[model samples]
Target: MLGAGLLAAAGLPATRAAAATPASTSVLISGSLASYSTFESKWNYLYPWGDSHNGSALMVASSSNHNHVSLSGGVLTLTSTPYVGDGFNYHSGTVYAKQQVLVDSSWPSWEVSGDFQAPSAKGTWPAFWLTGVNSWPPESDILEFKGSATNWSNTYKNTSGAWSNTLTPISDPGAWHTYRAVLKKSGSSNVQIQYFIDGVLKGTHTGAGFVGQPMWLIIDYQMEGSSGSPGPTTTTYFRARNLYLARSSS
Candidate 1:
């Protein structure tokens, strides 16, 4: 016969089980632009300022004469060459993705990634980042060399006050390395951003009031400013391959 205590405990109603959440499915949105025409199809040449952004004091992006942006051997190159144009000393390249990223119920997360071989010499500023298309304050820097041996991962949100940046050192800045960022919804109005280098996790931060907002993925090759004075006189390059965007599907 079973003990009375055991029988009494068995007789009690079992604890109610909690419902499980549905796992998200990752779907590819964009992949590598293998050719120049393909690159043009996926991205816009420059900002609304027309070949210039961020005050345009040092480098002005240009799409003319295959001077700044070009694709060769499956690798996209953004070159910075010394050019006396429009009161700017150097001409470089910048491109913005045609599709914007929106974190909503349909797509609660996103991923942007690329393999980069960027410059580390003085006055060289190359970055892969995302910013608001219609507003500011919601920005994420997946890879920013900042003219040093360190990569800077940053997230900006004015709603929460101030910004956040994490620096990761690289032994060789010109070597090829994978840079990735995953943006997932943390709550109804906030998002958690994670930065990865060479597929390894580097930094994770929260973006305040970033949910339901649309952001444009941008890659720019600039000169001077944060790097150092007297920009590089010789031609410099910012090379990237397999730049892509993915989303979480149902």
Candidate 2:
């Protein structure tokens, strides 16, 4: 487990889960605009915004002409071209399953697991994250960008003032891979958060500040370039599939 580092740019609901509690659930936010749960834009800032802010993340949808997100065979595929904004440029897309549609009905008490095809290149940052209905950064980020190269790895932020860590995967992220985060309800004795890579336990957290509250799932493409990372020289894209969200039986 890696310690929470200095900074980097930043950046669910109930129901579906209640009606159908699959031992595992696949979360794919794509295709027709109606397929997505509505998301209200929160923070639009760049990053490291003054002393660890809250209830805000940087995510935007594609313009009509640029929009290219879809759900095929239960997989959420996201793609887009470069766009100028916030003193920087980005060419990625994002969709949220928020509002009436949610992953869980409470807070500090949710787990998201799935396989993701990590983005290849320095500029690409893809993630599976969640946020509070009222606060921003406070939401947990289960998985994040796994850079392309030696020693490249993924990271997580338990924004609830819980715990955060960086993880190194055994396999290359260029190909499809599985990742999971189990957020157990905080108890008077033991509160824990577990992370797994490709079905292997990688890390765990305690005092995660995770309680019972509803949260929604969100997936998106992120770029680190202030100007869109040279604009994807060769058709780069992001894919997240076979996702599952289950409330702990305990």
Clashing pairs in 1: none
Off by over 4 Å in 2: 1-66, 84-88, 99-109, 149-163, 188-191, 225-231
Scored by lDDT, model 2 comes in at 0.49
Q: Write the per-residue lDDT of candidate 2 for residues 118-218, one digit (tens) a residue.
A: 67566666677665554443355566663453222222234355446655644567677787777665554234666777777777755333343344566
- How many clashing pairs per prediction, in order? 0, 29
Q: Which candidate's lDDT is highest?
A: 1
**Residue 93 displacement in candidate 1 (angstroms):** 0.9
lDDT of every model, 2 decimals? 0.80, 0.49
lDDT by residue (tens digit), candidate 1, 1-250: 4465665666732332233567676644455467666677778876634666652334344445566788888788888888776677787788888888888777888989999998988778899998887788788999887778899999997345778889999878798999999988887888899999998999989999888889988888877878776878888899998887888843
TM-score computed on alpha carbons, candidate 1: 0.84
